[model samples]
Target: MATFQKGILGGFSGKVGNVVGARWRGKNVMRSLPQRGSYTATAKQEEQRLKFKTVIGFLSPLVDILNRYFGSPQGDKSRANLATSYHLKNAVVNLPTGTVMDYAKVLISKGDLRGIDGGTVAAAAAQTLNFGWQDNSGQGKATATDELMVVVYAPELNLFYTNVAVATRDATTASVTLPNFMASLEVEVWASFSKPETNFAAISTYMGAVTVL
Candidate 1:
């Protein structure tokens, strides 16, 4: 198969010995076809590939924030790439489950002082929910300031409410006001903490699965 541009002069195709003609990405191109052989990867290889993909997709959008907070790897030019690769390799993807990441664990491994402890949730109002956690200022970790990401999933409506930056971890409790459009159903809340100066975001854990009163 040959890929051609929108207004290419002519079409090109047919296999010329090892090379095959094909059109790709708005241009005419040719490349060598695969040799006759089994193209399947081993089980372990597939598993690793999937893991890499999951990490990449999750962290790609936060490259700048990660680099800024985590700081650059010593003597390395590509700070964003460095953080991404390091976390992807050292991340424990099996803590909460084999496939899903236990969010706080990843952050702690990277450089967080510690994961939020004793996280508690309660309904503050008809549309507001409050979250509180033990202040880790006593830990004396590298970070002095904290931030949070709150994710709420409503199973009854199959909806998700995500607030990437709820607030700085200055206070012990943070409140989240949900949209009125969401169904009044039992919702599961997950939380992750990050330092203000570093990219270390703790692994997110389930806060609770409760119905708002």
Candidate 2:
């Protein structure tokens, strides 16, 4: 049985005979029920599935942040969707071992805002990560008040340490202290800048990988 919110003329949600109706991306959608059978995916289909899954899983940790600053929604696609599409195409790779992310190519945010100049990161004592950049505020679309955003991922633990709005672009330097458990482990880093009051952001830069001290 299907449920309609506004009589027979309105869109429905639920199962009706062989068809399934549901809301998708805010639109009413319908599709036929899958037939009961063992199905094998083609080589291309399998590849696509692996790529999609890899991107989605790799991005799960940053979903909320990305949705907030990655980019503006285009049509029905949200900011998260745009970021996922970008990573799938440019960051995931097919190597002999398997499909995996090229962490150095990842972007935590994407937009028209101008990025910091000479951005750099280094691991420091007490599991702290230090960041520095040449202040390019007032250049192009950049602003002195643009806030810094950083993401640190420790692959061995499959965990992330995110610091948003930790400092403004004009500060030229900032720091992030991770849990003690992260000490001595290798981690990947990325950084970006966003307005303190809006969802707009600069395209993030990979700050290179480092072993925590």
Candidate 3:
């Protein structure tokens, strides 16, 4: 491994022969490319790999939401990466068949902003979800104009239906109507709030499972 003072060929950015070069942090660097070969993973390594795949597959679709509310990035880790690390450690479970995600433990958004109070969700007419929450507008950093964010996932369908900035905190209620294709499907529901005036968000609440109308 080597760091170039003047940068090789003005900071090389690709592979040439056995060496690969790119900028890391703010400095140009070069290193030998990894040799291509087959290697066996240890039991622990394989388990970690499975957990990564499981979490990535589930969270990839929710990247926008995760990026917004998961948490601020630390050094090289982005918010999405932070979210993945968190679920990998806390939400994934190993089973006799394979590593699986526990839906109840899934977090669509995470932050220190004031969270929903007495939140609930239930099936309503026309494939809609009726969401209700007690108004907590004057509580800890909470404001009347903070908007709602909702996420619903249908695991059997492998799809997510989400709404961002849907309703104000004072509204105390909101509804989400899924596509007709989602009718009668059992879905997991979650809710959070974000202040429109700034990049602030509340940790989300999982409102339990409900069958869509």
lDDT of 2 by residue, 1-213 (tens): 333344567887778899999887666777889899999999889888999998998899999999999889999899999999999889998888999999978999998999868988888899998999998988888988999999999888889989888999999989889899899999999999998879989989998999999
Residue 81, model 3: Cα distance from true site in angstroms: 1.7
After superposition, the stretches of candidate 1 with alpha carbons farther than 4 Å from their true spots are 1-111, 140-144, 156-158
lDDT of 3 by residue, 1-213 (tens): 889877354778899899998889899899998878998899999999999999999999999889888878999898899999999999998899988888778888777788999998889899999889999988999989999999988988989899987899999988888988889899988899998856588888889999988
lDDT of the candidates, in the order given: 0.64, 0.89, 0.89
Q: Which 10-residue window in model 3 sums to the lowest lDDT?
A: 4-13
- Tens-place lDDT per residue, model 1, 69-112, is 45446764565676666666765373334554434334312344
- Which is superior by lDDT, 1 or 3? 3
RMSD in angstroms, all models?
Answer: 8.0, 3.2, 2.2
Give candidate 3's whole-model lDDT.
0.89
